[model samples]
Target: MSDSGRRMRTVLHADMDAFFVSVELRRRPELAGQPVVVGGTGNRGVVAAASYEARRFGVHSALPSTVARRRCPHAVFLPGDHTLYSEVSRQVREIFERYTPLVEPLSLDEAFLDVTGARRLFGDGRAIAAQIRAAIADELDLGCSVGVAPNKFLAKLASVEAKPRAHRDRIDPGEGVTVIQPGSEQEFLDPLPVQRLWGVGPATLDKLQRLGVVTVADLRRLDLSVLSTSLGANQARHLAALAVGADDRDVEPDREAKSIGHEETYAQDKHSPAEIRRELIRLIDAVTQRMRKQGVGARTWTLKVRFAGFVTITRSVTTQNTVDESQEIIDLLTPVLAGIDPSPGVRLLGVSGSNLGTPVAQLTFDDVADERPDWHAATDALDEIRDKFGSDAIGRGSSIVGGRIRTIKRGGQQWGPDQPPSREISHEDDATR
Candidate 1:
């Protein structure tokens, strides 16, 4: 192991098991041990969560619901209610915050907690983990798996191993939460597959495999320069550090989102420029609506396009000031799209905003003579309706050009939902087949 790999700090990875399906099962105990899949409920829907029972039949998240149905004929499938799921996630986070303020949420279901200082106030790592698990179970009625180790890498792996055994009544599972001491993080991670490391996706792993670097240990043995030549300097250095379990990034309290983006893959590749423009407008409207709901405006606009051949390219522009104007954003991206080679059929389209700032408020003055009195009155009325009913209560005609919009509400938080289904499927076959 490298010299840096030997140094370590206490880190904990805590994750809720089968979070979405588990949350659903909690309310309906009769569904226990049954197969459940949660996501969109339509012919074109995709799976968001699959119960362990459903997974046994090859059902998994992101898989088409049509295929999932073929695997688990009896599985209960439900359209994911983001609002309900978010409420449960909020309660779960509140439980974690009680234990440690230094919580870094990876997603709605998982988080990393820096309990290094909590040892003195609470107890040892294992004891603190037990307390956290108990608090979640007792207060939120949720099940969670926790791994306590000397650093983030090992802690994450330990959590994965401990997930299936978290229901154990005793202090130890069969292998116990594989605890790697201060100097053992690298040794524990070395034998794992190269693909297991963060950022080592399929493309990168394919490149590493061709070079005969199959394991983390093998990656560590390679010259940094050789790796850099293939993977670029930044990625190579990051991977080298990860190979030996030497991540120095600390658990942050408030990990602000650097960007907010959304993308959709069409059922078939689109070749028409007019069709693409229409889709772009829809995406821009959707994105801007979300920005408004979040009380944020962004200065950076990014466009991502994936061709039929799977080659992807991204173009971006940083503006002088934060903007949430849909038309302005679409205008800025028009030329960027025009510059791209349009011969390749586009399969996916995405829009993202970054360099966010506080939300902009429209100013109104009674003394203004040129302003449209009726337009200003209508705007104020719409804002009032949004504040009371919801953001989706009122929208401009241009906003809903080709699609219906839904409002997503989770606890006190509200935002625009993902695109709605063209048609709904029956809820009778909602459970796993």
Candidate 2:
């Protein structure tokens, strides 16, 4: 209990070490100590994960595959198997459930578990983290770093601190588990770099640096009025709270996803209207298929267009009835796409669904029956066929061209920046799948 008499919380953040590459290595034990990189090998490919051996040579996730190859010529590269990764991720979640019901998954490879209620059944936070690490090692042969803290923000940072680092000469095996007792949060955060704090990106770092703030301790001592002049008032206050360890967030479990989206950056800029249409249709098909699989429908559909110069624009359409059919979404977004000029060349295109809810069937009058087909039933049948065989076994004719339509894997990482393709304009790619 604290001075305020509130019950202390025990939050545990468990993050898989080199998740994508580690899953790949499980079957190929021969690659154990070798440098391995997993992602697309194409010129436009981005690294999804890299083994510590590969990191020593400066290979890391989100780095362009071309640059990764130049940096680590001897590294073995593998196209990530997202399906396999998802299956393993589920198994990992099951292990977390054995300890606590209040588990919040941050991604396929990491989660936050509120174990304050489970201390009696599973010892303390440190003991629980150790057991989880051992179980994963014993059952999945994978490495996991765990951080136990009093709050979510510090727990996530502690997990990062617990991860092994790759040095030029060798890999330093981390402590595997780090715990911060209550009342010690500020002590733990003081020495860390300010950039380690959430939302402190390159621009924010430069601003803070001009104020002579290099560490969390420095930021903590700086006047709020002074910091606000450099960073905005809201951002300055938020950082100051984190610097002094004043986070009050709880470990929320089973948070519902807000939206689903997908986007692709072309190796070469796409200028042709026909090519852009083909890509748009494919994206619509993918997003709706995901919606049907998840048993949700969207009331709004969003289209994203990024031209060659990186000038981005978005168009959105809303409907009274939820839509989960690919053709319907394509019909709605096609006109929206037509309004945008692609003359300068389109570098990226994206489609997404928002305002999602359980798809409800609307009654049709006999007179209008001829105008509308039972698209729900038709799509359900198609889904069964695809499930029995594979996603590519059957597809809409318009979405498929001469051969197969190119599709990127739905994974934890996206190709370019780690952020959503269009944060200000569209939704994030629903990577939970």
Candidate 3:
């Protein structure tokens, strides 16, 4: 194929292998070839990552730490080195940029890279995947899996098939790479079970199987109207399109983060709205601390409430000015807070800052000279004290007397690596005038 024609299959997905455990293994080489897990060491902590050896024992990510211990008592466990992992992920991104700037990160460990423009400069999609994987292995001594295909969907699936899985199941780990030609997507996906298709969760898979849809090939044979009755119109069409190996999503290189937030799943359900608000204040402190640390502010303050039934609803309010203060966030989110009927009890509570960018306010001359300086100076002074003593050194009186704040780091994902079970609905307002 000519260079232009070779562009037909140039998207590549690169994913690290057991990212957290791998990073930890670099320091604790003695644990190599042994079962190891990285996550919270507490009783309520969940698994974030598990080594292949640990996976064979049914110790996998998102499994409660207590259960993981029961499954593999001899496994070595550590909370994890997030700072080092992030640095390694940064280094890996730099390597991807060396081949293609069209890199879309799915998470800290996996990304999709569009290499159409990179073929002439590099070799081809396969060559670029090889080069990137080689760079990660050589420079960081890390194992990674790569998938090269015509689109993101197949690329992601190829990567998944290219790596190891739970219960000692693994695909072709040879070189940890899989490349699908431009027109072979259907053949590659047809034999795979219907459950492997995106959006086919356990419940959906059971529904599909009951309807005699066992594989992609079976799904492709169904009429649109038949599937629509069961899967909704939009989802039915979407799955049908995917079944035919049709996906046009682009590799977004500049997917800016829209918001930053922190939440906690309580050990037990909390019934008091006052208690829920107290947790919100504590969460606001962590979020604002991160905003200040990054020199980013927000024009909107948000609150997330997860009722006991796992229904999560988020409400956000835009302000006339930007803010990075805990008190200010509580004030802005009060209306939303009051609206929530906490009588049913809350399962989780969260706070966030959004409408990213430094806060802005309409300041008159007198306020700009006097009020702004004092407010800024006071917050700055508190920040310095926090840097010296710790986050607990400074606190708001309400938060201090209310309840103990749950402490988690911002160096990585706000929650455990595994996806949460709650359904999140965001309500946003226009801040621009």
Candidate 4:
């Protein structure tokens, strides 16, 4: 074992490099060394990921694509392929399990691994991180930055510093790997800016700046009273601990999803009542299919609308029956949908199902129409055919009547929803999916 392995670091943080764009580049290697971006491709589409090459031109995620074009006209923008990205993330995660079972995923592209318990079997924390990164590159053709430290905060900070082209100030590690010695956490963190602490945001920073707090070292000097004055007493205590590189939080192995729903952003605002209603039905169909496939039902349904100026409104309804069918959910939501004022044009519309629970046999208020055997059988048949064939094999006439909504995937295998070409998005693209 290497010397670094003799004294294993306790915590590690690993982040995949430009995950969305990197997955797209795997199939199109010709774009290597060029500025590449992935997101919605419409005029008002947003940038989701930009390559290191594109960052030189000030391109970044969530920046409007039109502005991104204005900033880097030469950059290649591809509509995000979320389905492929999710598969790749699964492969990468399996590799982490091979090294240590104490891995906690931060997102699809990042995770925190506690390797203190695996040193005898895996060498050390640094050795384990290297193995994970190399396996991802060799098996999945990806790059990542890994940081090893005494705790989660410093390890997370180290991973950021390890990113390519990160500006050096102090505590520079000069490679994709940064390992802070166990006893040197304070010395390595002191010279860093106050923002390096987790709780110090712009408002808190302004509050701290009003006093003399600037760097971690400066914060380390402030008494509890001053930090309480700058922030609340509770926040002050939390930041005080972080300032000295003391974090006792364990590396939890699981991060559970609290809710699930689908939403889309449009290239242009949609205003027509009929057009919007059609879109709503498609959204309902998509959300319900996913819900039923997962064997879950929701008591509440919400419709979200956003105007051109970004003024947004959300309306929700509680139904007597726990619902997962498109017709049942839309029946309860119809009145709420009619009340929306689409006058100024709507930029986005979404349907969300919350208050989820295990599937229950509902009698539908003893209504005879609700128990129609023919309709239930037909729905089952369509779902089955779509799974065996492709999603395009079968779809509701309502979804295609106006021909506006496209790309509907019936089975849960896919993450993208049915929408206009420019505004279409897949669930795999988002963490909630």
Q: Which candidate has the highest lDDT of all?
A: 2
Model 2 agreement with the true structure over 263-306: per-residue lDDT tens digits? 87776687867667877877887888888889999999999899
* Better-scoring candidate (TM-score), 1 or 4: 4
Residue-by-residue lDDT tens digits, candidate 1, 1-433: 3435424356889888778888988888899878898875554567888777777778777887789889889999876777788778889888888778889989889889888778788887788888888888888777788888867777898888776532223222323244667767677788889998999999999899888999999999999999999899999999998887776677887877788777766655778675666666667766876777677878899999988897999999987778776656777898887787756788778888999998454544743655634433454465568779876766644334235333323311111112444653221211111
* Candidate 2 vs candidate 3, lDDT winner: 2
What ranges in model 3 sit over 4 Å off? 1-9, 165-175, 265-279, 293-295, 305-320, 333-348, 363-373, 383-408, 411-433
lDDT of 4 by residue, 322-410 (tens): 76777777677777879987879987787888888775555555567665554455667877986798666667554543344354442
Q: How big is the positional error of residue 157 in model 1, measured in Å on the Cα after superposition?
A: 1.9
Misplaced by over 4 Å in model 4 are 1-9, 166-174, 319-322, 369-378, 401-405, 408-433
On lDDT, the stronger of 1 and 3 is 3
Comparing 1 and 3 on TM-score, the stronger one:
3
* Backbone clashes (count) for model 4: 2
Candidate 2 clash figure, as a count: 0
What shift in Å separates residue 393 of candidate 3 from its native position after superposition? 7.1
Clashing pairs in 3: none
Ranking the candidates on TM-score from highest down gives 2, 4, 3, 1
**Which pairs, if any, clash in model 2?**
none
* lDDT on C-alpha atoms for all candidate structures: 0.73, 0.84, 0.78, 0.76
Residue 194 local lDDT, model 4: 95
Clashes of 3: 0
